[model samples]
Target: MVDRQYTAWRLYTVLRVRSQDWGGSIVVHQGMDNDGMALAVAANLCGAVFLGLEPDPAQARVVMRAGFCDFLVNTLDEALRAMKNEVRKHRPLTVILEGDAAAHRAEMKERGVYPQLQVIREGEEPIPTGRVEELSAMLATADAAHSLLAMVVTANSNAELRGADRAIAEIIPEGDPRRAWATGAPKFFVREQPPRRYVWLDDPELEAMLAVLPAGLTIEPLSHSAY
Candidate 1:
């Protein structure tokens, strides 16, 4: 029993603490990009339930298949209403609304979605898979700053020196962050083992996501022993 408690405590300590430190779970919903997807995966791995409020039906299907998040009200007004009710029920939550600086501010202010919600701007739409090699090189330069690295594998057949999936998978077993999407699978994985900080690596939408990442969130590279 002591060992079990120790392991649980240790895990809670090691996973990312930025969002949960505020004393609640986080909800991440970005535009038509995968940055939100990455956050959804990482947040869950860190033991925080991340709800994705994607508006596009096509994208919503992908979100469901990726096995990372929950469905929520899509529009800003509806989202705010839902969140308020959730909070009123004594549920502590930090909602991350996605959009750029201008759009994010305007949406929240114009529609009154502030306070309980944290705005994370949707990053630039990702580059077509053709740029995967270039993207890989760019990410490698910044790899030293992260702990665990994961990549988003787009279903593309572009002819490149190294395909996006191949490039990212070379470093991490799966270009995926959510492991065991199968029934009764582990919802998350530890950051160490192959450096999970790379979760945001090699995506076009990364810039926008970075642009609005809260100022205080510190990403320390986990362990590299798995490599």
Candidate 2:
């Protein structure tokens, strides 16, 4: 337990801390990015239930699939309502609420339940996939974008990537922070676009996925494994 606490503390830079009357602590992070994901995973590993309130359906699907939270509520009211059920589970709880923290915190306290709440604004949307030429044009712009190519394979590709089925087989960069939770079976993958360069080390499926990748941005397969 102490080891786990030390690990989580080392993985995340806690931006703020405050006392809670309910005998828990509040941990704050700047945004719902890699660090936030780390917190959710760490909390669960430490026997705390992690909950997230995300209103965007597309975003919610990604978060849920990644197991970022045990329970995800679409609204503040819904999150507040679920607190008791978490309390009944006899475990520490960590709640991440989107939007204004003050209002949501006040409402939560009014209901006589306090847990470690993570307040954050909406996260940036994934860059839309586009034609190779079109995406290449974006590089010249001030707001350049990049993609994190991830291969998420499922034990059964016929079914959705969920539960024990989904596993991240490979990530192009191979050193991305998001690889912290890579587990499960070999199935299919999803790409978070637009990547500066698409490198293929001989995965036909990954190669096919980037068939339209722009010229000059594709690298030839290198010898020897870097895994």
Whole-model alpha-carbon lDDT for candidate 1: 0.36
Candidate 2 residue lDDT tens string, 170-214: 432444322223321111122223221112123654565345333
Candidate 2 colliding pairs: 147-194, 152-189, 153-187, 153-188, 154-187
> Tens digits of per-residue lDDT for model 1 on 100-149?
42454456556544332232443433221211112222223333434433
What's the lDDT for all of these models?
0.36, 0.36
Residue 131: error of model 2 in Å? 49
Q: Which residues of candidate 2, in runs, are more than 4 Å off?
A: 1-9, 12-30, 53-58, 92-102, 109-112, 116-227
Report clashes for each candidate as comma-separated counts. 18, 5
